[model samples]
Target chain A: MKKTNAGKKYAIFFCQQIDKNQDVNRRSIEKEFGPQIRFFPIPCSGRIEPLHLMRAIESGADKVYVVTCPEGACRYREGNIRARKRLLYTQNLIEEIGLERGMLELIRLKAGNNYTVDKLTRELLG
Target chain B: MAHKYHILTSPTPARFKPITKAGIIAWEEGCLKCARCVKKDCVYKVYEKRSLDSRQMLDSLDTACMDCFRCVQNCPNRLIQKSINPLYKALGDNYWTPEIIENIWNQAENGRVPVSGGGYHGPFSGPGFDAMWTDMSEIVRPTRDGIHGREYISTTVDLGRKLMSLEFDSGGKLISSPPPLVEIPLPVIFDVLPWSPGGKGINLAFLEAARNTRTFAVIHQADFMTDMDEYVPNIILFADDDVLKLSKEMIRRLKIIELPDSGNVMAIQEHLKKINPALVIFIRFRLSRNASVRAAALAKEGAEVIHLTANENGMGKAEDPLFIKDRIRQIHSHLIEAGLRDEVTLIGSGGVAMAEHVAKLVICGADAVAVDIPLLVAMECRVCRRCTEGISCPVDLENIDYAWGASRIRNLISGWHNQLLEVMGAMGIREIRRMRGEMGRAMFFEELEKEIFSGMGIKGLINGK
Candidate 1:
């Protein structure tokens, strides 16, 4: 497939445990999207602070997608929940700072699902 | 084979993006979307390399922009502007002003003296350290260039007691056993920070820099780690009622130890001296109302070094406080009156914000100064104090590479050393020892105002009271 989102930059922050298939999926995504997209694999989504999300936006990313494990299915118990709250906080801060809304999105992986990364990337950009 | 004293420094960039003084504001709403936008045509290419630092959440464009105003002027729709950054304004408190913080940052990044592009546009005079001006009458003389090594100006200072009078046996052979003295090349020593987002990495950075600079770092006895054994000679252990922590071997390895001025401080000093008679002991105390009398008394009581500490703003710790420079004057003159000034070394700390402050403090009476806050600023600490309230450091100071942090601290000291040399060169002083307590070479605001403008009723106006 050809990349269609011209000049649109996207950042994906995902938990390492959330996607066991990230290695394969990342390769395929890199082949398809190239430098237009970036992936950051963190230990847990709970480690994602407002600074990380805001910095991505500030760095000229059109949209930032944080992929977490399914709600309550986190190996660390509340990683996804904390990620959701931090995303909301960041969204509100950008709004107050005169930036557009919906820039920061939190996505939860489907329980027991493989290829969630591919599914989400296509679903968001398609 | 000892080499002449010189501080080696290299360009050590900050790990975090610094908060710039001004940030650009560009609006895309009214952009003509010119074939060649002004942003692309900028000489600095600030827009092309625009990125955000994750550690500080600071935009690179803000710092990279050289304030050339090309973009602001060339924007077709007048949509671009520059404004003072709120973050920069909020960097430090009144005492540690934003200008001082930025100056330290620049000095740390490059080991060069910070020369303002425009020649000296600050106020005539201000508070505490600013109120005193060094006599630079010999600045125009070319042969007195100390920084270029044309003339050897010694910045080395001794950190131990000396004999007032030496006795000799028959045939003029010396009989008195002189006390041990540790000479540091720089008049500046790294003191314990008033506050910091402290960690092993930070403490190690200080020790490493102290080792590289050949100066001392005042480490608390409790913070002394076995890993720091190699740096023991460069470490001045502050044994605050914890003299027991220092083993005989450790005491012997150390060059100096600082003890709080407790009731039995003399007994403790004597005991430490017995363990290592070559050890230099520093007696530390807060500067209070009767600090002059107390300093004289301690010197007569055989204190090796009197470390008089004021608050961070240079105000003495008392209900009615005097500035550290004034306090240093008082204590130094008191020792002189008691004929003990040459016998005891006096180290003044607190409120030393710049290199000039070091020279000014020495002129006011300190043998050398213990610097605290500038070391933190050199490591990109904004003095936000978030760590004090248990918040994670914005700059992530705890995780900084020790080598990078040490280089930054070393670079800062190198810059200060050069500036000190320049000041001394300008003042026609060849050595830092001669500059100490040279009050005639400096013009104090309080003194000058009272001398010239006193009849015109400019007394309180001197400090703008």
Candidate 2:
């Protein structure tokens, strides 16, 4: 961990149903990634406001990951579609304000049991 | 006891967490794990007390950090860094700059004159009010310090027409009926905001603050609620398109009513005067290329008060717009030339963003100023226009308690009043009336530039333009 950006803070906002895909233990994730890695579970990805995402960065998160359901697979029909539009808007606002690019990411997970929160966190670390 | 006007103020904290100017981006990646870490050396204890407010999604470190930079300097791995907060930078538009918003917020919270530690690092001169400098030539003399002096410096200003001369009968009795006039302790008034979160609470806050300060708040005829009856004395009914909405009782109770300039403006003024001869009516209109001509005509027409307004940026509506300061000067000069300057009151509105702008506008010829956006900013508005776009206000301005909002507004005015006193004292001007259009006590950047540098290029000079 003695390297630049190794201890960077992160926040992951995901749909609550995404946890059903794989057995993701929140305590285990905290034990491995340390307290800097934060989690926020929402009922649906579309419920997230652009203010929430911008506020995450303002709250000292180096990067934010918004995990949404796959296209057309959202239980709320167009929830994932709405989330994508909001994420795009938030990204543009960040860039327009001269903030670092790529600080925000929108991840659309496929409808399968192959994904886990722990695995997703490790993949982002790379 | 002789009535001495003073605004009582107390510290009123912000209803919501403010967007701070700078944020520390400290990454803990390369931890040497020293026996005594740099985070522990923070004298402000900002690092140890670091926590995120989930509701606001704000970092405590950003607001609590004194910016001593000790932690940044002592970090062995060079991990800590300070950068301008993007949210702070995006608070307001180009006209209402982030710095101005921050200053207003600080003043509202503490009701204190803002004093930055560092010397001024801003440009010497820019556009509009920045292009003029108030002469503080008497500053070295201790007696001129009005803020802590025994001498009384009056910021009071009258808000209606004045009689140029009083005629006497042969028996030495007054023969003319004196025109009614209203006076306020300060030269500032609460004007209608261009847009807001839109709630009764917001309007109540403005009215309450106006009542508490013994000043007038401009309320449109449409927004007049029955609950505002108690504040009638402090409310100036802005008669928009329709004057029939006003009842005689309401007119009699009110001290002033503003009428939008129309084709039959004088007839309407006369009609309103018939209802309450003691009432003062102010003629309101937008500033344009013909603003001076229109203002002089209005003065000649016996308009008690002529309120000239510019846009939010102090720019008039024209193909080539002039700033409010220049427009006020033009209208003032025009009225003086026509021998009508002493008859009417000129209340300048728009783009008065700071306390110094208040004094500067008066120096440029305005008798008083009407403020709009800064009052909203006192209520923690970021000028983000979210409320205007039908988006929820980030600060929850719609749900604010009117009493708290009123206190914050009062605090802001108190801060401005104190600063006004300091500026007047420095200029050795005891009364605000004398400060009006006193161009001899001020300096303009354009005139000084032309006087100093205009001759350089004409004569044999090095690379003169």
Candidate 3:
């Protein structure tokens, strides 16, 4: 049985601070999912600019997601909050250009929760 | 030169998906997955093309679904719904409202005046500039179309002092040489932003836009680089250095320069004139309790221009601060009483966040207005002031391509110029110079309410009597 969903491509931009464990079984997920899921770890979600998201979509992303630390928990203080606003602003821009706005999203990781990303990914794929 | 002033514009697409006003929520619980599921029947194919943003963890269904309500009504489980996005509500602050920021963004993207299909739905009166209304000439004379009409309406304005009386030389030739004047096609000038993360790139963009528009941008002398020499003709150096320290060649190359107002400002002006008489000097002063009297004195002393700047909210720095409009009126009236109104030009800055504020400031007494914040808005700034706090700007404005930034600023200015033209055309004024100090053509809420409602029959209604 296949461990990952087929045919759909997903791009993930996660903040490095959220999953500090470095070896969070991402390789197993990637190995199981193969090229269907791509992970781009960023220093902070605040570094996720509007162009980066647009380029991801323009580069053939079926969907793009930004994973960040929970509000008030960002290592850089307001990184998550700023990321949220930028994501929304980017959504509006894409909608104006005839793109579906739901192609982008911002996910906040629960503090001290190690299994949330995996669970969220599984739920999303399902 | 032809009287034509046209702003060339091109469509510049946004690099990111913009925050939309609303988002849709569709619950999947208790789904029967019927033969003809409501999702399959979505007119917009929102469900058929549904995908998840793995990064943001958002469902594409929310963004793609048009608010037709077909799915909401047809869904057997009634799982579909729409709600206003909280992020949309958080775009801007009290003064730089979200709507205004969005409008500026649209204008910058397309260089078109935002046209709402429906009638005006906003309140008739509110605080600040909204409380005043300009009288339109459409009812009396419908033939004149301001912006798109056959007749050319000029927006050109001169920036310099004018001689009160003409003097002749011994040979019967005019010897009272006119002061050097810089004529800009538009009455608006680019003012340095109060706060921005994008240092040189933003300044370059502003300078480029100012040059393209044939206007001036007030740049701090310290920030002026050697590479920016080509734009010197359109650059107004706000000099902090002593007049004697500035090279004669630098003064010669520049068209206009601004100096901070001080007790010895006249002496400094005279010293600058000796270096380059062609340079138009503008004294920059903060709007305060003594601004009116000070302005009158400066004009009497033969100051070429006076730039009166209020706080960010257009309020003075006094205990009981007057608004920019009131301060300008006071200065204008004081100058008029001193018979020096025609000697100097008044350029008002601060709290000029919108195009309408430009016209209102002019009507109150400014010959021109210097705008700062709207330019930042054009580049999609939310006025979050995170940059001021030494934090990274969410927009990454510092890395912005100068071309893109310049184009956005140009488009924003184009929108403003069109609006100014419309106002002038509707007021039966052909030139912006004529629009200045035309207070009679505009009605202030305070004045109108007092005149019409004061001592009226209705008690407690007029200010509760």
Candidate 4:
């Protein structure tokens, strides 16, 4: 499939435990997108505070996405659940400030889905 | 010993961007992207400075938006809108309301009394503590400097038994030795949380807060760690079955100990006292239907201190549960009738969520109150009870930084202390001890409504007259 718009800027914060491999494969996405996308790996999605998401937008990312393990599947047990609440809270906060709610997204990764970081990035970007 | 008690406070900022009450909605697909776009024309520059918090997936726009609605008005495509944030509305439960949680969060973060800015906007009376109004008749008095005034209002309270009468020998030096007493600078103590994601960090935080505020924290003996030795003075170990196992040195180090009320509660108190004569023993009992009778019996049995605990919502565990205030009143009056009210200290716990509650509970006959949930709320707990379900805390309380947690709790206690002083000063009382069981200084809605409207034909009309 064609990659997302080259001009749109996107930032992805993915939980480190989501994939079996430690490597996030950021270089491939950067090579194709040419720095239009940025990747941040967090220990757990729950570690993502509302301030971090707000700061990302302030730093010029047009869209921010948080990728985490599916509900009740997190190794830390409820990190993803909490991450979802924080995402919705932040979304509401930004929406109040006259910003589009679509700028922020939470992507829950299913177990054994065989989804690649590049594919997820492309999907979020699109 | 002097009556001046002050809580050292410092500002502790929130780690996360708090969920705001309102959010704006603006459609971007149909944007004209005009040179004078409504977004750019924002007086607060909310749109221009809009940013995403990549870590939390939060947008700065919501926090930065001043709720001016100018963008909505000027949007050529009419795509801008504003509404209350559902997430903000969803915080906390019926007992621990969202506004209460937010107020505690603000107090903890800033170490300041929550001034509503405008005048009181809430109802005149409701249920529980809300149904009673304190006499702020002294508000018109010029000497009403409660928190920061030159004149000091004492919040100090004493624990343990006091002799009703004193006797002296023929010799001037001869006198009866007074019972061991423990005094706290504040009229509040840290009670065991009803439910928590247990960890050493949380316990240490409570202990540290108790030490900082010169109050006590009731900790289960099993939860106590050896590293907590430094805070031994501020710790009240609640021994269930571990009383005999505690070493003499450990028992001696503790100033006060609590034993569960059982058939042999007096024997337990006696055995513990024999182990450490200096230790002030507290009989911890659940508030139930017969709680007042039990409390009176305990007092008459020479119990030095009695800790009556209610449910999380301050209701007794019964078919028809009585509120904490009423239960405390019953216990207080029963003790007074038995002439044992002056002998034993009564510490009430449960449903003490706010600073005003400290005053209300005291007026209801408690010597002091032990708080549980407000401390958690100070540490940013939403009271979601996910921890009770074995789920990880949304705020990650299990691994919380003890220093930050302690400061937050201290800040909360500080706010409560100031509020207590405000209530006391407003009642023209200089000491918290005098505020205890002073029911005349407070108005109960049931009593007032009955007195004013019972005889005006309203009762008969309500009965289908």
User: Taking the candidates in order, what DockQ does each have?
Assistant: 0.06, 0.05, 0.04, 0.09
**Which scores greater on TM-score, model 2 or model 4?**
2
lDDT of 2 by residue, B333-399 (tens): 9899999998999999999999999999999899999999999999989887756656556678988
Worst 10 residues of 1 chain B by lDDT: B23-32
Candidate 1 or 3, higher lDDT? Answer: 1
Per-residue lDDT over B1-465 for candidate 4, one digit per residue giving the tens place of the 0 to 100 score: 494677789999777666666666424435677724334568887777776655445567777776777787788877556666544665776777777888899899888898855589777787888889899773465475587778878888899999998888878663877889999888788888889988788889999999888999999888888899899999999997668899988988899999999989899888878888899999998888888788888888889999989888888776536889988988899889988999999999988889999899999999989999999888888787767656545567888898999999999988888988888888888878988999988999999998777667664476434
Segments in model 3 whose C-alpha atoms lie over 4 Å from true places: A1-126, B26-78, B138-143, B169-172, B241-244, B318-320, B451-465
- Please write out the lDDT profile of model 3 over residues A27-111, one tens digit for every residue: 4465566667777655567656677788788777878888888888876567688788888989999999998898998888777
Worst 10 residues of 3 chain B by lDDT: B22-31
TM-scores of the first chain across all predictions? 0.88, 0.88, 0.86, 0.89
Ordering by TM-score: 2, 1, 4, 3
Per-structure clash totals for the candidates: 0, 1, 23, 16
- Ranking, lDDT, top scorer first: 2, 1, 4, 3
Candidate 2: give its CA RMSD in angstroms: 12.1
For candidate 2 chain A, which ten residues in a row score worst on lDDT?
A20-29
What is the lDDT of every predicted structure here?
0.82, 0.83, 0.78, 0.81
Give fnat for candidate 2: 0.04
True contacts preserved, each candidate?
0.11, 0.04, 0.00, 0.15
Question: Which docking band does candidate 1 fall into?
Answer: incorrect
